[model samples]
Target: MSSIHPLSMASPYIRIAHDFHTEENMRIGPTRIVDHALHYFKEGDGVYTVGNRPTTIKAGSLFLIRPGVPFSFSASPGTRFHMYNLHFDLIEQEDSAAITFPYPKQGEPQRVPLPCCLPDEQEMPVSGLPSSVPLVETATYEQLFFRILQRFGQPNTIALLQSKSAMLELLALLLRQTENQHASSTSDGTYETHLSHAVAFIQSRLHEPISLDDIAKAAQMSKSYLLKCFRNIYRLSPIKFVMKQRIERAKCELLYTSKPIKTIAGETGFDSIHSFYHTFQREVGTSPGAYRALAHSTALQQEEPE
Candidate 1:
C-alpha cells in the first residue's frame, strides 16, 4: 500500500502552484514529486501508472499523486488532454505535534485537536485510491479549480492564502470521496457491487435532482432493497445522503467563492434562498455569509507573518 500523510492541525504553511494544460501525445514522469499533487482531467483519456499499478484516466477523473510516489502518464494517440493540476506542500512547523483537549464535565463539549499526521497503522487505504479516481463535476468543484487558476493569475499575499485554503478544501473533499469509495468496495458480496453503483450515480449527479427511484434503477435493484443496502453501508437513506452531499458542496462555495448566497443556493440545487438559509443554519450552525466571513478572517490571520 502507498503511504499517506494526514493534514496538520496546526497552521501548516501550504504553498500552491497550479496550471491548465491542453495537449496531444504528451508524456510525463516515471519520476517522483517532492510535493503532493491533485490533477483534474477535463477532457480526453490517458494512462497513469503508479508503481506497478496502472489506472486508466479520462475526463472528470481526479488523480491524487503523493510525494515520493513514482508515477508516469501519457495521453492517448490522436486525442488531446485538457487538465488542471495543482502541486502543494503542507509544511508543518518542526515543533508542532499532536494536541489534546479535555473537558471538565461529561456533558460539556469536547474539542480535541485532530492528529497532525497519521500513524502507519492509521494511514488511509491508499491502494483503494490507486492513481486516478473519478469525481462528479459539481459546480463547487469546478468553481474551486477556476478560483485557484484565478488566484494564481494574480499573485498576492491574500490571494495566496485564499488559494491555500481552497486547495485544503479540495484535499478534504477528495479524502472523503476516497473513504466512501473504499467502504463501498470493501463491503461483502453483491452488496459491495450494488452500493458502488449507487454511490457513483449519486456523485455523478450531485448538482441535479436525484430521486430514490433513480438511484435504485442505477443500482439495478428494487427501491426497498436499495434502501436497506444503502442504510446498512452508509447508515443514511439515499435521499439523506444526497442532502449531505449538497450541503458539503455548499460549504465549499461558502468558503471559496464570493458569489451571492442566492446564486450559490441555485448552483448547489437548493430550491430557494430560504431553504438554503435554513439548511445552512441547521447543519453548520451559522449563516452562509457569516461562515464565509469567519473563514476568510481566520485564513488571513493565520497567513499573516508571525
Candidate 2:
C-alpha cells in the first residue's frame, strides 16, 4: 500500500462497533460492504474471501475492507469465531445513521449507491492503508480495539468522544506499524540499533555541546545516512531532536525546581542565557519565567479543592 494522508487529518465518524460471533462451520456473505470497516478476529479460524480471493484467517488477524468490496467469511469446522468489527466514515456525514449495510445485497434491485457511502479515493485518508495489519502478538492494538467497543454503546458524551479518540489512535498505530515494517526491510536491522545508540549518546551528554559529527560518530554511520535515518524514523533532524530534548529538560526544571532560569539554561548546554531565552521563546511560544509562573499558578489551582 502506498503512503496515505495522516489519520489526524480526518474527522472520523464511527457508525458501528460490534462484537460479532460466528457459529461452527457457518458461512456468511459473499456480499459487498457499504462502508469502511476494520475487523479484528479475536478467536477461532476462518477463510475470508474477497472478490473470489480466499485467505485463511485466525485469531488476532486484523483486516481493513473498503466500501463496495465483495467479501465472505467461512468458519472452520468445530470452531466458533469471534471478531471486533468497527465501521466508520473517514469524514463525518450528516446522514451517517441512515446508511444501510451491504449496500445493495445480492438479488436486490441495484439502485444508485449513495456518493457518501462509497469510499472516495481522494477524500478517504486511509485509502492507502494495507488490507491487513499484523496484530497477532501486539496487545496494545487489541486493547485499543476493545476500548472502541467498550465506549461505542455508551450513552454518555464522554464515552462517545473516547471511542472516536481510540479509533484515531488505532489508525495511527496501524500506519506506524506499516512504516516500521518497511523501514526494517530496507535498513537490514541497523535502523533501531543506530537510532537507539544515537539517541542514547545525545541524552547522556545533553548538558554538553552536541554536533552532527558527534551524533554520527555515536551511531557509527555517515552524516548523510544519519540524517536520512533520523528523518525517516524520528521525523526530525538530529539537531532538532537535540533542541527538543534540551527544551524539554528545561521545562521540567522550570516546573519542578526553584532553580534560576539562567542557571537552568547553563546546565542545559546553552551558549548563554540570551540564546537560551530566544530559543525557548521560539520553541515554546513563551519566556521561561512566564512558563514557570503559569505552571505554578495552574498547579496551585489544581491543588485547591475543587
Q: Which number leads on lDDT?
A: 2
Mark the 10 consecutive residues where model 2 has the least summed lDDT: 114-123
Candidate 1 structure quality by residue, lDDT tens digits, 1-306: 934354534233343445457667888878765445667777779888877778888767777676556788889997778877765545543422221121123464432332133221124454234456546434446667755655553435776676667766765565555565565564455766777688778877776789998999999999998887767656789998888778877877777668898998988778899999998899889998898888677656654555
Which 10-residue window in model 1 sums to the lowest lDDT?
95-104
Point out where model 1 deviates above 4 Å. Answer: 1-25, 34-36, 42-44, 66-68, 76-129, 133-183, 186-190, 297-306
Supply the TM-score for candidate 2: 0.54
TM-score list, all predictions: 0.63, 0.54
Best by TM-score: 1
> Candidate 2 local accuracy as lDDT?
0.73
Candidate 1 overall lDDT versus native: 0.66
lDDT of each: 0.66, 0.73
Tens digits of per-residue lDDT for model 2 on 1-306?
865354656667788888778678878787766667887887889788767767788766787777777788888888888888888876676666666553555686553453244322335433446565544223456557666765665666666687788888888777765555455443466776777678778867778999999999999989999998888865789999788878877876787679999999988899999999999999999999999998677445544443
Pairs with steric clashes in candidate 1: none
